[model samples]
Target: MHPGRLEGRYVAVVGPADDARDVDLARAEAVGRALAEEGAVLLTGGHHGVMRAAARGATAAGGVSIGLLPGSDRAAGSPEHTHLLPTGLGELRNGLLVRAADAVGAVGCSWGTLSEIALARRTGVPLVLLDPWDLPADAGVVAADAPAAVRAVVGLLAGR
Candidate 1:
Protein backbone atom coordinates (compact mmCIF):
# COMPACT_ATOMS: atom_id res chain seq x y z
CA MET A 1 0.00 0.00 0.00
CA HIS A 2 2.88 2.32 -0.66
CA PRO A 3 1.54 5.29 -2.59
CA GLY A 4 4.97 6.30 -3.81
CA ARG A 5 6.06 2.82 -4.93
CA LEU A 6 4.65 3.22 -8.46
CA GLU A 7 4.70 -0.56 -8.87
CA GLY A 8 1.04 -1.18 -9.64
CA ARG A 9 -1.40 0.26 -12.11
CA TYR A 10 -3.15 3.36 -10.79
CA VAL A 11 -6.53 4.56 -12.02
CA ALA A 12 -7.94 7.93 -11.11
CA VAL A 13 -11.71 8.14 -10.75
CA VAL A 14 -12.60 11.76 -11.51
CA GLY A 15 -16.00 13.40 -11.14
CA PRO A 16 -17.98 16.01 -9.30
CA ALA A 17 -17.51 16.49 -5.57
CA ASP A 18 -20.92 17.76 -4.49
CA ASP A 19 -24.52 16.60 -4.85
CA ALA A 20 -23.78 13.96 -7.44
CA ARG A 21 -26.71 12.13 -8.95
CA ASP A 22 -27.44 8.66 -7.63
CA VAL A 23 -27.13 7.15 -11.08
CA ASP A 24 -23.72 8.75 -11.51
CA LEU A 25 -22.61 7.57 -8.10
CA ALA A 26 -23.72 4.03 -8.92
CA ARG A 27 -21.76 4.12 -12.14
CA ALA A 28 -18.70 5.46 -10.34
CA GLU A 29 -18.99 2.68 -7.79
CA ALA A 30 -19.15 0.10 -10.53
CA VAL A 31 -16.08 1.58 -12.18
CA GLY A 32 -14.20 1.49 -8.91
CA ARG A 33 -15.22 -2.09 -8.23
CA ALA A 34 -14.24 -3.14 -11.71
CA LEU A 35 -10.85 -1.46 -11.44
CA ALA A 36 -10.29 -3.19 -8.12
CA GLU A 37 -11.20 -6.54 -9.63
CA GLU A 38 -8.50 -5.88 -12.20
CA GLY A 39 -6.01 -5.21 -9.35
CA ALA A 40 -5.62 -1.52 -10.24
CA VAL A 41 -5.10 0.90 -7.38
CA LEU A 42 -7.82 3.57 -7.09
CA LEU A 43 -7.11 7.30 -6.78
CA THR A 44 -9.70 10.03 -6.23
CA GLY A 45 -10.15 13.65 -5.19
CA GLY A 46 -10.98 12.47 -1.65
CA HIS A 47 -14.04 14.64 -1.17
CA HIS A 48 -17.75 13.82 -1.31
CA GLY A 49 -19.98 12.72 -4.21
CA VAL A 50 -18.49 10.45 -6.86
CA MET A 51 -15.03 10.39 -5.34
CA ARG A 52 -16.32 9.05 -2.03
CA ALA A 53 -18.49 6.46 -3.72
CA ALA A 54 -15.63 5.21 -5.85
CA ALA A 55 -13.29 4.95 -2.87
CA ARG A 56 -15.94 3.02 -0.94
CA GLY A 57 -16.37 0.59 -3.79
CA ALA A 58 -12.63 0.04 -4.11
CA THR A 59 -12.18 -0.55 -0.40
CA ALA A 60 -15.18 -2.86 -0.25
CA ALA A 61 -13.53 -4.93 -2.96
CA GLY A 62 -10.36 -5.18 -0.82
CA GLY A 63 -8.34 -2.86 -2.98
CA VAL A 64 -6.19 0.13 -2.14
CA SER A 65 -7.79 3.59 -2.22
CA ILE A 66 -5.67 6.73 -2.22
CA GLY A 67 -6.99 10.25 -1.86
CA LEU A 68 -5.26 13.34 -3.22
CA LEU A 69 -6.93 15.99 -1.16
CA PRO A 70 -7.18 19.57 -2.35
CA GLY A 71 -7.29 20.85 1.18
CA SER A 72 -4.63 20.68 3.84
CA ASP A 73 -6.77 18.89 6.42
CA ARG A 74 -6.41 15.15 6.17
CA ALA A 75 -9.62 14.65 8.14
CA ALA A 76 -11.59 16.37 5.40
CA GLY A 77 -11.08 13.43 3.09
CA SER A 78 -13.62 10.68 2.61
CA PRO A 79 -13.65 7.91 5.15
CA GLU A 80 -13.07 5.27 2.48
CA HIS A 81 -9.64 6.63 1.52
CA THR A 82 -6.88 4.26 2.76
CA HIS A 83 -4.13 6.80 2.06
CA LEU A 84 -4.65 10.53 2.40
CA LEU A 85 -2.39 13.03 0.65
CA PRO A 86 -2.93 16.59 1.79
CA THR A 87 -1.86 18.41 -1.31
CA GLY A 88 -3.38 21.78 -0.35
CA LEU A 89 -3.39 22.66 -4.02
CA GLY A 90 -7.13 23.02 -4.41
CA GLU A 91 -8.37 21.91 -7.83
CA LEU A 92 -4.85 22.21 -9.17
CA ARG A 93 -4.16 18.87 -7.54
CA ASN A 94 -6.18 17.38 -10.38
CA GLY A 95 -3.06 17.57 -12.47
CA LEU A 96 -1.19 15.41 -9.99
CA LEU A 97 -3.90 12.77 -10.08
CA VAL A 98 -3.94 12.74 -13.86
CA ARG A 99 -0.15 12.49 -14.04
CA ALA A 100 0.04 9.75 -11.40
CA ALA A 101 -2.46 7.47 -13.07
CA ASP A 102 -1.56 4.98 -15.75
CA ALA A 103 -5.08 5.68 -16.97
CA VAL A 104 -8.11 7.70 -15.93
CA GLY A 105 -11.84 6.95 -15.97
CA ALA A 106 -14.26 9.81 -15.61
CA VAL A 107 -17.62 8.77 -14.20
CA GLY A 108 -19.70 11.91 -14.59
CA CYS A 109 -19.54 15.38 -16.06
CA SER A 110 -18.26 18.46 -14.27
CA TRP A 111 -15.84 21.29 -14.71
CA GLY A 112 -13.32 19.40 -12.59
CA THR A 113 -13.86 16.17 -14.47
CA LEU A 114 -13.44 17.97 -17.76
CA SER A 115 -10.19 19.43 -16.53
CA GLU A 116 -8.98 15.99 -15.59
CA ILE A 117 -9.92 14.61 -19.00
CA ALA A 118 -8.11 17.43 -20.74
CA LEU A 119 -5.08 16.91 -18.55
CA ALA A 120 -5.05 13.19 -19.22
CA ARG A 121 -5.19 13.72 -22.94
CA ARG A 122 -2.56 16.46 -22.82
CA THR A 123 -0.26 14.28 -20.71
CA GLY A 124 -0.72 11.21 -22.95
CA VAL A 125 -2.48 9.20 -20.27
CA PRO A 126 -5.31 7.03 -21.56
CA LEU A 127 -8.66 8.67 -20.83
CA VAL A 128 -11.89 6.71 -20.53
CA LEU A 129 -15.11 8.65 -20.40
CA LEU A 130 -18.08 7.03 -18.70
CA ASP A 131 -21.26 9.00 -19.18
CA PRO A 132 -19.16 12.10 -19.47
CA TRP A 133 -18.24 14.52 -22.23
CA ASP A 134 -18.63 13.61 -25.86
CA LEU A 135 -15.28 14.43 -27.35
CA PRO A 136 -14.40 13.80 -30.96
CA ALA A 137 -12.90 10.43 -31.85
CA ASP A 138 -9.70 12.14 -32.85
CA ALA A 139 -9.39 13.62 -29.38
CA GLY A 140 -7.96 10.32 -28.12
CA VAL A 141 -10.65 9.96 -25.47
CA VAL A 142 -12.32 6.57 -25.20
CA ALA A 143 -16.02 6.61 -24.52
CA ALA A 144 -17.24 3.57 -22.56
CA ASP A 145 -20.13 2.37 -20.50
CA ALA A 146 -19.71 1.74 -16.81
CA PRO A 147 -19.19 -2.00 -17.22
CA ALA A 148 -16.73 -1.60 -20.09
CA ALA A 149 -14.66 1.29 -18.77
CA VAL A 150 -12.27 -0.95 -16.88
CA ARG A 151 -11.67 -3.15 -19.89
CA ALA A 152 -11.11 -0.10 -22.07
CA VAL A 153 -8.60 1.25 -19.59
CA VAL A 154 -6.73 -2.05 -19.42
CA GLY A 155 -6.63 -2.32 -23.18
CA LEU A 156 -5.43 1.24 -23.56
CA LEU A 157 -2.70 0.79 -20.96
CA ALA A 158 -1.59 -2.47 -22.58
CA GLY A 159 -1.26 -0.77 -25.95
CA ARG A 160 0.75 2.02 -24.42
Candidate 2:
Protein backbone atom coordinates (compact mmCIF):
# COMPACT_ATOMS: atom_id res chain seq x y z
CA MET A 1 0.00 0.00 0.00
CA HIS A 2 1.06 3.58 -0.59
CA PRO A 3 0.16 4.69 2.93
CA GLY A 4 -2.01 7.36 1.45
CA ARG A 5 -4.42 9.46 3.41
CA LEU A 6 -8.12 8.62 3.63
CA GLU A 7 -9.16 11.82 1.93
CA GLY A 8 -10.43 11.33 -1.58
CA ARG A 9 -10.44 7.58 -1.08
CA TYR A 10 -13.52 5.55 -1.86
CA VAL A 11 -15.04 3.66 1.04
CA ALA A 12 -17.92 1.34 0.32
CA VAL A 13 -20.55 0.75 2.97
CA VAL A 14 -22.16 -2.62 2.36
CA GLY A 15 -25.22 -3.90 4.14
CA PRO A 16 -28.75 -5.18 3.57
CA ALA A 17 -30.90 -2.87 1.52
CA ASP A 18 -34.38 -4.36 1.70
CA ASP A 19 -33.86 -6.41 4.82
CA ALA A 20 -31.78 -3.91 6.83
CA ARG A 21 -32.61 -3.38 10.46
CA ASP A 22 -33.04 0.03 12.10
CA VAL A 23 -29.85 -0.24 14.13
CA ASP A 24 -27.84 -1.19 11.09
CA LEU A 25 -29.31 1.64 9.11
CA ALA A 26 -28.37 4.11 11.82
CA ARG A 27 -24.84 2.76 12.06
CA ALA A 28 -24.45 2.89 8.30
CA GLU A 29 -25.60 6.48 8.28
CA ALA A 30 -23.18 7.43 11.00
CA VAL A 31 -20.36 5.64 9.26
CA GLY A 32 -21.15 7.48 6.04
CA ARG A 33 -21.23 10.79 7.83
CA ALA A 34 -17.94 10.15 9.56
CA LEU A 35 -16.26 9.07 6.36
CA ALA A 36 -17.54 12.16 4.60
CA GLU A 37 -16.33 14.35 7.42
CA GLU A 38 -12.91 12.84 6.89
CA GLY A 39 -13.06 13.80 3.21
CA ALA A 40 -13.70 10.36 1.78
CA VAL A 41 -16.17 9.47 -0.94
CA LEU A 42 -19.00 7.16 0.03
CA LEU A 43 -20.22 4.24 -2.10
CA THR A 44 -23.36 2.19 -1.70
CA GLY A 45 -25.69 -0.25 -3.45
CA GLY A 46 -27.83 2.72 -4.43
CA HIS A 47 -31.29 1.57 -3.37
CA HIS A 48 -33.17 1.66 -0.05
CA GLY A 49 -32.59 0.86 3.61
CA VAL A 50 -28.93 1.08 4.64
CA MET A 51 -27.81 2.37 1.27
CA ARG A 52 -30.23 5.26 1.26
CA ALA A 53 -29.51 6.10 4.83
CA ALA A 54 -25.78 6.22 4.23
CA ALA A 55 -26.20 8.31 1.10
CA ARG A 56 -28.40 10.72 2.99
CA GLY A 57 -25.73 11.08 5.65
CA ALA A 58 -23.04 11.74 3.11
CA THR A 59 -25.16 14.32 1.38
CA ALA A 60 -25.89 15.99 4.69
CA ALA A 61 -22.15 16.22 5.30
CA GLY A 62 -21.59 17.88 1.92
CA GLY A 63 -19.80 14.85 0.56
CA VAL A 64 -20.11 12.92 -2.67
CA SER A 65 -21.85 9.56 -2.80
CA ILE A 66 -21.54 7.17 -5.72
CA GLY A 67 -24.26 4.61 -6.15
CA LEU A 68 -23.75 1.45 -8.14
CA LEU A 69 -27.12 0.13 -9.17
CA PRO A 70 -27.70 -3.45 -10.23
CA GLY A 71 -30.48 -2.42 -12.58
CA SER A 72 -30.15 -0.75 -15.94
CA ASP A 73 -32.14 2.31 -14.96
CA ARG A 74 -30.14 4.93 -13.13
CA ALA A 75 -33.31 6.50 -11.83
CA ALA A 76 -33.95 3.36 -9.82
CA GLY A 77 -31.22 4.40 -7.39
CA SER A 78 -31.81 6.56 -4.39
CA PRO A 79 -32.05 10.29 -5.03
CA GLU A 80 -29.68 10.92 -2.17
CA HIS A 81 -26.81 9.57 -4.21
CA THR A 82 -24.65 12.28 -5.79
CA HIS A 83 -23.76 10.02 -8.67
CA LEU A 84 -25.49 6.89 -9.95
CA LEU A 85 -24.16 4.22 -12.27
CA PRO A 86 -26.38 1.51 -13.67
CA THR A 87 -24.34 -1.63 -14.15
CA GLY A 88 -27.12 -4.05 -15.15
CA LEU A 89 -24.95 -6.75 -13.61
CA GLY A 90 -27.54 -7.65 -10.98
CA GLU A 91 -25.96 -9.34 -7.97
CA LEU A 92 -22.65 -9.57 -9.73
CA ARG A 93 -22.21 -5.84 -9.26
CA ASN A 94 -21.17 -6.63 -5.72
CA GLY A 95 -17.74 -7.51 -6.99
CA LEU A 96 -17.41 -4.22 -8.81
CA LEU A 97 -18.48 -2.32 -5.76
CA VAL A 98 -15.98 -4.08 -3.54
CA ARG A 99 -13.22 -3.77 -6.06
CA ALA A 100 -13.72 -0.05 -6.45
CA ALA A 101 -13.49 0.63 -2.76
CA ASP A 102 -10.23 1.47 -1.00
CA ALA A 103 -11.87 0.06 2.10
CA VAL A 104 -15.19 -1.47 3.10
CA GLY A 105 -17.47 -1.22 6.11
CA ALA A 106 -20.22 -3.80 6.43
CA VAL A 107 -22.97 -2.65 8.77
CA GLY A 108 -25.40 -5.56 8.79
CA CYS A 109 -25.78 -9.18 7.87
CA SER A 110 -27.20 -10.37 4.56
CA TRP A 111 -26.27 -12.67 1.74
CA GLY A 112 -25.33 -9.71 -0.42
CA THR A 113 -23.31 -8.14 2.37
CA LEU A 114 -21.48 -11.40 2.92
CA SER A 115 -20.53 -11.52 -0.73
CA GLU A 116 -19.10 -8.05 -0.59
CA ILE A 117 -17.19 -8.84 2.58
CA ALA A 118 -15.72 -11.93 1.05
CA LEU A 119 -14.73 -10.04 -2.06
CA ALA A 120 -12.99 -7.34 -0.02
CA ARG A 121 -11.06 -9.84 2.03
CA ARG A 122 -10.09 -11.81 -1.04
CA THR A 123 -8.83 -8.65 -2.70
CA GLY A 124 -6.80 -7.60 0.37
CA VAL A 125 -8.90 -4.52 0.87
CA PRO A 126 -9.29 -3.20 4.40
CA LEU A 127 -12.63 -4.11 5.96
CA VAL A 128 -14.59 -3.37 9.10
CA LEU A 129 -17.66 -5.04 10.54
CA LEU A 130 -20.30 -3.28 12.61
CA ASP A 131 -23.20 -5.13 14.16
CA PRO A 132 -22.65 -7.79 11.56
CA TRP A 133 -22.35 -11.56 11.43
CA ASP A 134 -20.01 -13.43 13.71
CA LEU A 135 -16.78 -14.24 11.97
CA PRO A 136 -13.29 -15.29 12.93
CA ALA A 137 -10.96 -12.63 14.31
CA ASP A 138 -8.97 -12.48 11.13
CA ALA A 139 -12.08 -12.01 9.02
CA GLY A 140 -12.35 -8.29 9.78
CA VAL A 141 -12.07 -5.76 12.56
CA VAL A 142 -15.29 -5.67 14.53
CA ALA A 143 -16.37 -2.16 15.50
CA ALA A 144 -18.75 -1.20 18.24
CA ASP A 145 -20.21 1.69 16.29
CA ALA A 146 -19.92 3.86 13.22
CA PRO A 147 -17.16 6.21 14.38
CA ALA A 148 -15.04 3.30 15.47
CA ALA A 149 -15.60 1.59 12.15
CA VAL A 150 -14.55 4.68 10.22
CA ARG A 151 -11.49 5.15 12.41
CA ALA A 152 -10.50 1.54 11.95
CA VAL A 153 -10.89 1.82 8.19
CA VAL A 154 -8.79 5.00 8.13
CA GLY A 155 -6.15 3.33 10.17
CA LEU A 156 -6.08 0.33 7.91
CA LEU A 157 -5.99 2.43 4.77
CA ALA A 158 -3.21 4.59 6.23
CA GLY A 159 -1.25 1.41 6.85
CA ARG A 160 -1.06 2.18 10.57
Q: Name the candidate that leads on TM-score.
A: 2
Per-residue C-alpha lDDT of model 1 across residues 3-91, encoded as one tens digit per residue: 32222789999998775789889988888887787788999999889999999898998888999999999999999988999999998
As a TM-score, model 2 comes out at: 0.95
Q: How does each model score on lDDT?
A: 0.84, 0.90
Task: State every prediction's TM-score relative to the real structure.
Answer: 0.90, 0.95
Q: Each candidate: how many clashes?
A: 0, 0
Model 1 lowest lDDT segment of ten: 1-10
Worst 10 residues of 2 by lDDT: 1-10
Clashing pairs in 1: none
